[model samples]
Target chain A: MAKSIESLIPLSETAYYILLSLNVPRHGYGIIKYVEKLTGSRIKLGSGTVYTTLGKMSKVKVISVYQDRDRKTVYELTVEGSKLLELEINRIKIVYKDTLYQEGLFNEQK
Target chain B: MSKNKFRPFWSYDVLKTQDWLNDLSFKGYKLIKVNPVLRIFQFNKSESENKKHIINYDKGLDGYPIYIKDGNDYTEICYTKNFYFLEQISDEPNSVPSYNDLVSRNRKIKYIVGQMLLFQIMLYSFFILIVIIFTLGIGSVTVESIPSNEVEYTTIEIMSAIAFILVNFGYFIIQIWMIYSFFRLRVSNRKLEVFCGDGIDMSFTIPKDTILTKEEIRKLRKEKKLIKKTKVAWFYSPDKIEDWLEQMELKGFNLIRMSKIGNSFYFKTGLPRNVKYHVDFQTKKGANYFSLNKESGWKLYFTSYSRFMAISVWGQEYTELVPKYYSDHETKVKHAKKYMWTYLAVFLPAILFVVLSIGMSITLFAYANFENISTWMILSPLIMLVLVVELLFFCFKVIRYYSRVKATEL
Candidate 1:
């Protein structure tokens, strides 16, 4: 599982999920909520981490920053950012099926 | 109380000064008194007490230059050598004229005043020459005569304005160049290397560290031979400092404002023991200072013991592993981002006025300074008018700034 995680762009597991959540334009808090829902709260994006990552992402041009037509900074996935999200989604699909097939008779152990 | 006199870098660093003092003492240069940055010494081994070698150790802003006196003539040597032990107190009870006595005997202030007067004359002549060169040089290119017709005045006025700007442009640039040559510093990063006089090989920005560390404060106390002093840790760069701050909430670093010196921050630590990656820069001087802590500081100074210039551990010493090369290069280019603001801020337009004045004077001079009038007598009123206006403007600016300061304080 760790090997699978390492196969993608070098991002902390939390950053990948937050970037994954921002497939649509999202505000700062919205991204946090979306990451919590998507990762089942397994990855908590701290405020400092989120703000600093947003700054870094904007600097690298991975994400496009926009005003929400009302002055809040709205972040949307650029084509490059979208492609990275696609890779994560595909990896999760593989993991999802592998777990279901391998744990059918091992379910009572939990 | 013997006050010592010292020169610049040459007499100390290049001359192997401390050794020279020992040699001079062996040659009989008696030690008199010592100060922080100077040492005064003299010797009287004759039937009549006389001067042999007057060697001094000095540290000044432009780096130290030493003055040596041998009787009828004197030579000054300047270099970057540590020569603190150039003199030791003499044991003999003696009443001979000290070095201070000799300097008082040699005041050529008369010559200095003459030089200053000559300087004023040359400056005045140069200003007139520059203006004349511009006028005659440009005047030769203009139409032989202004059109006798009334309709041509507009074209003539337009041409005059353009010519005015061109002459002023050259004049102002030259003035700035002069000021820069006279006062712009050529300070090699002094703290980084004790310049060996052979070459300046290294440069680094050591924070003035003006807010002396606790260790530094204690050392200062020891120098003053005091019983105690206080210590504190205030950060310089809050962003880099945030990494070491205990709390998660980013609190800004505190700063103290000083009237004469400007703002400062202070910090202190024990003998740094943390092992981490660092940058090592060694210069011609045997001294090496590196950083491994917050600023990654470790000194391999010659004044220290045998371990001076030795590297303990700094980020797996790789050859030429400079951090952030691409961004650093980008910063090196003077992008002129604030060019217009700087031009206005430094009053470069005044350069235009100065050039205009000089060019006008020279042109008027070459044109016979209006023949009937005495050139200087006639020029004085106009020059005074210009000077008065300039002084009034500058005075207004200074007064306004002071008024703003007073208002803020109130």
Candidate 2:
């Protein structure tokens, strides 16, 4: 058996973005566009990258095929996927707080 | 005036050949038709425009419309068994970039290489088995080693033996060459850089001192001073493509096009200079992939079903150029796993065949000289030998591929 989800913490940026975009069911192309828009065009997902990521995510039960809408295939996050995204977001928030405090760039939050 | 011509090129020289096609387009000629297997291309006279022919290695035409929608005004021109040609005509002065991402491109490379390894193993095993069966059948009838009869070999038997040895020797050389070429390409390209791009259409400022005006390009073309030449090479040798292109540039022949399959390189006369060539594999290209590479100051020239080659032009003084796309260690390991799975899938059945062949040979030996069997009985041992050799060769290839992956991992 593969490692547990705990061991796979801190998902890659692309993987994290994909999970975040799957809050609503989105097709492969839709996920790409959504991620780009969310990141202000800073993260333009390549078609191959999205295809491969989707396959990997599906295999891990993190995401699944929502529907086969004509020419496009849509995917949505599973319960496990949403949980992972929540964990990752919290991890990022902690990291951000730690970095700012360590660098003495910010004071305590109100 | 319209003109047409037919030319044959090797299947591996697709990069230089695409460049040659673009050069022709620049000189008022456009590629119209190409036969993938025959490596033949047809070009017709046309007016010059800022057009680029993209030869990309991809599995199929799926999502092809995305390319058109990406805004290069792309049209599906033609395709070979593994690659498709997309022609992008832009009224703008420069070419639009490709749409493949670095990670996916790297993945595509590993996948294709793994699949090819599996195919070679399966093909060679079958071929060896057939050859062994035929040779043993013919060898048994020669009456050369029957215990009761005098051991005298016929002239035909001796000639057949020689032919068998020669054929195996030739096959061994070809296999070795394939491995060597692959390693050469891998090692030479090890220095390629992996960079993150902004994924936008932005041009780098070319050194103002080195810019060539349109007038100069036209003046040289009108002088009829341009020289063209073709060089053929083995399809697996992408390193050779780089070396030959560099050598030609040193001699003042600028690469113009690579034959559709990359078997031939077409060059035109130019000032002796330096150029760097790099290759990446991408089965499915994306618009952002091109935007990334173009943003990095690389030009996409040739693509086949599995790989694409790009070039960087600089003066002779420039060296130590970084590549735009390179597979990382994790990707290499993943590719290794893919190759291992394929090897196992084929090797399991191959082992069964070997066991069966050994059993058949034992049975044949038990019956040897005891039963009045036809000459066909003698073929058992030969077929077994061939099967054993095929398995060994397969193992060797698997090991080599694994080692390459491991080396990359390290």
DockQ of 2: 0.06
TM-score per model over all chains: 0.24, 0.36
DockQ list for all candidates: 0.01, 0.06
B1-410 per-residue lDDT for model 2 (tens digits)? 54555545332344446677788889888777677656667777778855677665433322232324435456777666545676766544122322222224444454465567678999989999887887898764343545846677799998999999999999888667566545543432231112112222212212233233557646756775543345542322333455666787788877654545556554567787667665344333333344434434455455443323222221122246323122234443553455455555666688788888778777777867766766666676677678777766666665665565576432
Interface RMSD values for the candidates, listed in order?
27.9, 13.8
Best by TM-score: 2
Assess candidate 1 and give its lDDT: 0.39
How does residue B145 of candidate 1 score in lDDT?
60
Off by over 4 Å in 1: A1-11, A37-42, A105-110, B1-231, B234-410
Highest lDDT against the true fold, candidate: 2
Cα lDDT tens digits, model 1, B42-132, are: 3333232232333332221122211111222332323223222222233221211111111111112223433455676699999999888
Worst window of 10 by summed lDDT in candidate 1 chain B: B95-104
By summed lDDT, the worst window of 10 consecutive residues in model 1 chain A runs over A1-10
